[model samples]
Target chain A: MPSAPAGTLYRGREGMWSWVAHRVTGVLIFFFLLVHVLDTALVRVSPEAYNAVIGTYQTPIMGLGEIGLVAAIVFHAFNGVRIILVDFWAKGPKYQRTMLWVVVGLFVVTMAGFLPRQLMHVFGGN
Target chain B: MAATVPDLAAPRDPYARRKTTRSNYELYGWIFMRASGALLIVLIFAHLWVNLVSGEGVNAIDFGFVGGKWANPVWQVWDLVMLWLAMIHGTNGVRTIINDYAERDRTRLVLKLFLYLAFTVVVVLGTLVIFTFDPCPTDAAADLLPSFCSSLPG
Candidate 1:
């Protein structure tokens, strides 16, 4: 028999990269969720307290940050479905690479739909 | 002529244990991730639509806006479910990451300890906030309260 290959099975492939993105986004979302809950909890303290914090989120910088946050969440959500299909569908293994492209396409369409409206909200005075 | 069939089920070593020592805990965790992930996609997408995409978008979110939404039972329950499911799902995801990266036993244990602790605190605090929230606190300025608050009888 021939000698085995030197490199790893998943080196720099789409599957590996998507897996990395999923983990990174998942961790980022988790941290955001923790802080989100805490910020919402400020409602218990007082309206002023809550408003003071939430007001910051409405600023231009944070509005941009919200875009990034939503981008991460959207990618994670789509990729998560791709993962589920890969696990459960009969032909999933055969088509995982194709599915990644589909996920990217959907991500682009989604961001396209979201960006304009959100941009107006952020930059449109009042 | 009589035909004899051998017992295919018989173990080669009679003294050896037949069953595996493995439990289904990890299997169940794996399934939970997929199931919860599917549900969270819907829950959170709708959540984003309402909170960030509709009407005034992010600019509309404030104490009064939150108070208005939580005033209804539907929103209260919606948020409660979202809070619980998201926390559990996120905690479990992080736990998996910790297991993968943290090679040392002590390191894994300590990391998971904090993970679980944060999960419990966030879940409990979020649940309480949703259920026990007073949309119209009398002490707060009227301007900060939802418009409907002023109409309610004290």
Candidate 2:
């Protein structure tokens, strides 16, 4: 099998990297959800405040951030299913590496489908 | 005899008793993560499509926009399920992290205590907000209310 470069993260097994990515993505989504809940709750106080807060999200910078959020969520969800298969399926453990590749493929496809439309909306003029 | 020092870097015994108890709790947690993840994809994506991708996109959102959505029972149920599932899934994931990394009993307990506390607060507050939300209130100042609410008979 081909090897990763010496002294690099690539030396780790697919499962290891999957775990690391899962944790990172999970944390990112968690914080994002926290902020999201707080902002949505603002509608109770006043619509003006809620609109003002959401207004900031329409900017170019936030548009880019939305892509990153979507990527993190896709990775986490894909790898999470892989983990479930590994645990539950009779042949799962044997094909975990294959599953990881499948997860990567799906993530790429989904993001590719998403990015163009998102960019048009973001960079598209008012 | 010279004093002997244990090798700190040596591999631990594979057969050693586990520090934490073995239970079906982890099995349940694992299952919950996948189940909630599947649901989140649909819930989250639809939410994004409506709020960010649909006609006029994010700029169209405002108090009235949200009020309009929540006026429908379908959207209300959708938001409620999304809130509960995502919060629980995220909380459990963090709990796993704490269990794996916190070496000390006290540290693990403290961390989990706070984690559960936050989870409780969010879930409780979120559920209340979803179910109890009233866009137009007779008690609220008219200026703060949605324009649609004013159009309704007093």
Candidate 3:
């Protein structure tokens, strides 16, 4: 990949990186939502069928995957708010960089709160 | 002689003016994303809390658990609204992404065709499942059904 020359407008700064991250997370969450709806639709089948599939979600591997999925969701959600502010707030563009950091900060705090609880649920014996 | 100042807002060439036929579809789409996004944060966060973070967490999410939740009209509406809003939000987001990256028109069309197809299938199926869901199927073992199912008059 060719490196960008100096003085480009975007220059891969916080603004560009945040935008890239938002797009990536948005697409990931959308695909997950598709599969989630399909899996949920299985309730129309039989209870046994539904349980059998949802059971897979309880496994350790999928539990870890859930962490990643939730991480993506949390980031996407916070960054989405940032994007809204950037569009609507009078001072948003000026504070866009600060808001990106705020988004990251909130993501860390949210994951911190969620991780241990989820980890215990997955690994802690019933 | 003083130079005459031209109005910046005026068209450079009156004969070159193009007829405007733009609709506000994209504008509405932009507004919808922000609006739906704010609502979805609340909807999905509550959804995750109740389903994944409460009780036994993921392990608590069995068929009966779902049946129990959907048994309430509140949850039913909550889920129905969530389903519609989330699907539309996600579909529009993906559409934007496709429009951005898909250089070829045909590729964008094909991708969006599949995207809309998936959206329709999921939305329709989910709506049906939410409305028509039977907490207790006749053939299912009694233990597998939600507690409320037993109290339900046969």
The Cα local distance difference test for each model comes to 0.92, 0.84, 0.91
Show model 3 residue runs off by greater than 4 Å: A1-10, B1-18
**Model 3, A13: alpha-carbon shift in Å?**
1.2
| Superposition error at B150 for model 2 (Å) | 5.1
TM-score of chain A in every predicted structure: 0.91, 0.89, 0.91
- For residue B38, model 2's alpha carbon misses the true position, in angstroms, by 2.2
DockQ head-to-head 2 vs 3, winner: 3
DockQ of 1: 0.60
Stretches off by above 4 angstroms in model 2 are A1-11, B1-23, B137-151
With a 3 Å backbone cut-off (N, CA, C), the pairs that clash in candidate 3 are: none
- The worst-scoring run of ten residues by lDDT in candidate 1 chain A lies at A1-10
lDDT per residue as tens, model 1, B1-154: 2366765656665766679989999999899999999998998999999988999999999989999999888888888888988998999999999998787799999999999999999999999899888989988999999999999998
Return the top candidate by lDDT.
1
Ranked by TM-score from best down, the candidates are 1, 3, 2
- Per-residue error at A124 for model 1, in Å? 1.2
lDDT of 3 by residue, B16-52 (tens): 6577799889999999999999999999999989987
